[model samples]
Target: MASAVFVLAPLPLGSVDLAWVCIWTAVLSASLLTARVDHGCKADLWFMVPILAAIAAIAVIVWIQVAPNILANLQDPAWGNARDLAGIDVPGRISLTRSSPLLSFGYYLVFVLGLSRAYLLGIDGWQAHKLLKLVAYASVCYALYGILSQLLLPDTLLWRQKEFYLEYATGTFVNRNTAATFWGSGGLILLIMMVRSILHKSDDADSARVRFLDRPATQAVGCGICLVAVGMTGSRAGILITVLSMVCAIVLYLAPLNRGGWLLWTSVRNSLVAGIIVLALVGSLAMGRISQIGLVDGQRYEVYKTVLDMIRGHTVLGFGAGNFDAAFPPFRPASLGSQGIWDRVHSTPLELVLDLGLPAATAVFAVAVFFFASLITAALRRKRDRHIPVIAAGAFFLGSLHSFVDFSLQIPGFGLLFACVLGCGLAQSISTSTRGLARRAPDWDSPILR
Candidate 1:
């Protein structure tokens, strides 16, 4: 339910309060239920500790900045400017905007709750698989609607008038890039399931080719729809990043097929070749659109340059959490002649550095890298239930790369969903303990075996 709420919300902004309430409610309810049934709410989701700790550290920093006169040195010049303009002493704090940091903290908590709930649920393979299936189906619904709505009501989204990107399919999101990421995410999961179906159905890869072509092609249809929607989004980086991640996931997931006790890299190569062939057919539109736009947006590149310049000055303490709107204006150069308010800097890590300082942002970034490595390692090591880890690993690639050029993962809905998926995969990847180490071995001396 938490995972459902994390992704199903129509708009990340308008629905955030409700999403927070719903997801946290689901988490608490699940915990209580587990305590009642299992006598405890124990979960081996230790892998999430690094990221969770990073969030907590950032939250603490925000709290400090929000605390009046606690660290007089950390207060921003904006607070002093307010006092000078009013000719009175105002509260000294680091954050230029109080509500923004508080709101950021709220979103962080919601994400953590979503991840925690998913980790617990994913411990049970049956339940975890069911949850993933539900998510995949829901994603297809999103893609289907996104594509249909583009055709029937290009200038509309849900009950509202869509003022921008009318030519593209954005589904519930306002930004085409975010929508692309969402669609691409769903597409990756479908691709995984489809590939898994092929691997699980037959032992001989060569023999399975004909059988695969003959089997029902339902998953392929879903993948195609998702690809089409992503293509229609017209986000070049989004399309390329997603497709590359899918191919990598395919290659890695099928890397070491142990047939007759002989490990073969042939299947890995074959998977890559097959992926290219299938994508050429299924993702033609998305692939075609990749060459439609130049690799970089000039305006966005300038923004990145300016943001990097800003980060150098305030590398220690940031402008404050969620106060990018407040911090960006003074730093905005006249050369970039855009009259629009530049709140988010298009790049999540750069924006994060501006909001949470270098250390905090680096901590967050490092955690992602850690997950990428851990999930891949686990995917290779684990025999059964490796698909879940594979999906999570691919998602790390998709989310991290998109984050460099877009802010999709920062959206409360997408962020929470990503967190949930990562948590679930990490939970499944770790080996479950079969027995307590403290428990004495079954009385071998007691002659039951004899």
Candidate 2:
């Protein structure tokens, strides 16, 4: 249900915002009505503290950006210039607009709510498996729709005209890069399922090998279709990052070779060979597109340089949250060309620094590092469900790497999807033993317990 609302709404701006309303409502309702607080799982949720703190810090900065200079040191020289021209005192602070950051808080809520909702449901191993499978199926459905639409419609999204990216398969998104990340995430999930079956980690390892081979390879073909959709997007970095992330996931799956005997060795060899074949064939799908654009986007590279300079000037307290569109005009270098309206920095970190300042961006980065470390810890600790945490970590890496060059994760739906996946996996990965339990629960009624 959560996946469909995000994946199907390709034309966004208003549509994306609406999707958030529905998602937040459903997640919140489910959380309030049915979500339980298991002592063990609640303890594990402490990992989200840094993330919440980062959000709060940005919120405070946004408030300060809008506060009166006399009160919060947010005076803008632009207001002075306006006052002199108008012959009347004009008051203004940092942010160009009041609503942008306040509206941006919605995106932040998506991250928090997505993870919270998923973590709540993921406490049960059964539900976690179901969640993973649901995402995988939805991805395949979207991938097939994109491939068919590119072939059949060619110029329309639903009933409306595409107007741009006519030749590229964008799935349900407006941008091909975002589509690539979306499908690539799906492709990665499919690959994880394949690896799990191949590893023969099922309780009945003896029969797992035969059952895996005997089963129809629908997911293999599904992965191919997903790759085809990704390739059709013609996003060079998207293709490269997706394939690299898949390789990393494969390596993580193969890490426990010591426990394997002759049977597992054969499975590993077959899995590796298949991985090589898939990489070469699917990678070739994007080769033509890569050749056309080469490695660097010249125009985009200049924009990145300008954004970097802007960040340097506003290192302490940035212009304002979601104020990049207003903050960028003065700093726009001539080399970037004055042809387009520049709002997004195309890089998440640069934009965050531009909006909330460097310290806040660092806090966000630290939160990510902490989560990655937790995932690694889980992978190392768990014997049975190791793939869950490892795949979650790999998924985060995929989105993070892509965010460096493109803003896929900035898209509310895509970011929320990853958050939910991470939340679900982390819920399962954490020890969840009696560690999160209170030591004094047994003595609650006794005076000594107090």
Candidate 3:
């Protein structure tokens, strides 16, 4: 799954009518068929939640809006892209969700299920490690590409487009920032996996014959490559989030929650060492040209201002999804004249609420809180294995923090990666005896000993 994400991320699907979606449609059909045959298999049910919810939500919203005018429009409904569906349109035929809806309802369904499959099938760790390896390898490859790009075909890359001068080392991606976001997520994931392995002394082995995550030294080297690649991407948001995640992990290490003794001390020590390694690798490019970092900082601040103005203008329902640029042109303060169209608000939650309405935004937020809360609880439960909660909390926290500055979730590739992590965390929790769902409680204070 990780390799698939990494490989496909750099490529553009262009229109919503792309053929790749059909593969998922096939998967969904097969899952249903399998369920019918297997009756009560948990594996089949795992991937259905997000897809089912998205379908249900879209269906309800469409029905509610068109029920009044269904009879009138039944002959020839007003068909159009999803953006039209969300706007203040009259009741009519429900938009075909398969079309480019706000969240690409069909895509999200697949994302949720894929993650769920990783968790239930117990391949989460293996897949994560595999993903890390791909990042490491890709980073190494990108490093070589960066050198070549600087020396040779400096002006020819298509993704570079007109932003050639401003472009940082984007590797295979069209935009430097997008490349950075990709490698940044990869670096952080690699670090988390390595740290977990070293601290817990657990083997990352599984039935799958992947020799990738089992060896410690190889994993560390891969992480080094990824760290370098991420830095080269020159993404402020990615760097910020990576640093924040490390800081959180360090604080967790210092706490005596695990053993409160020498083992705790060792963990903290290891955590510090790991943090230093990450910093050294990521900060290498900035060592000589620290001033450039400052320039990037200013650009980020300007972007933030733009995002704020956008929010202020559309507080009730922010710019519609995929309509950031369309909405921004009018709302943008004249002070930043002709700032150009922006595909993203660079902030996920704000963008989500702005585009999908407050109710939809609230639902997304609830899902995040639920997952994070569960992860934190799992981490503190002492008896539970330390690595699972630690990875989940660290990854989720890091990604969430990063989202404040950039819309990682909006990117199909990163969004899918995140869903996988979330699914793994949820699966781990379920696997543990402490089921999160409400069950009949044992009669409290009804002890026979009393």
Best candidate (score: TM-score): 2
lDDT of each: 0.71, 0.70, 0.51
- On TM-score, the stronger of 1 and 3 is 1
Candidate number achieving the greatest lDDT relative to the actual structure: 1
Tens digits of per-residue lDDT for model 1, 354-423: 8888988888777777777888987777655677888888877898899999888777656765766787
How do the residues 303-391 of candidate 3 rate in per-residue lDDT, one tens digit apiece? Answer: 66776665554444333344455555555666555755565677777766655556766776776786688667655543333344555
lDDT of 3: 0.51
Q: Give lDDT tens digits, candidate 2, residues 283-352.
A: 6656776677777878778889998887776777777777888777888888877687677888898888
Arranged by lDDT with the best first, the candidates are 1, 2, 3
Q: What TM-score fits each model?
A: 0.84, 0.85, 0.69
- lDDT of predicted model 2: 0.70
Candidate 1 error regions (>4 Å): 10-45, 201-216, 258-293, 433-450
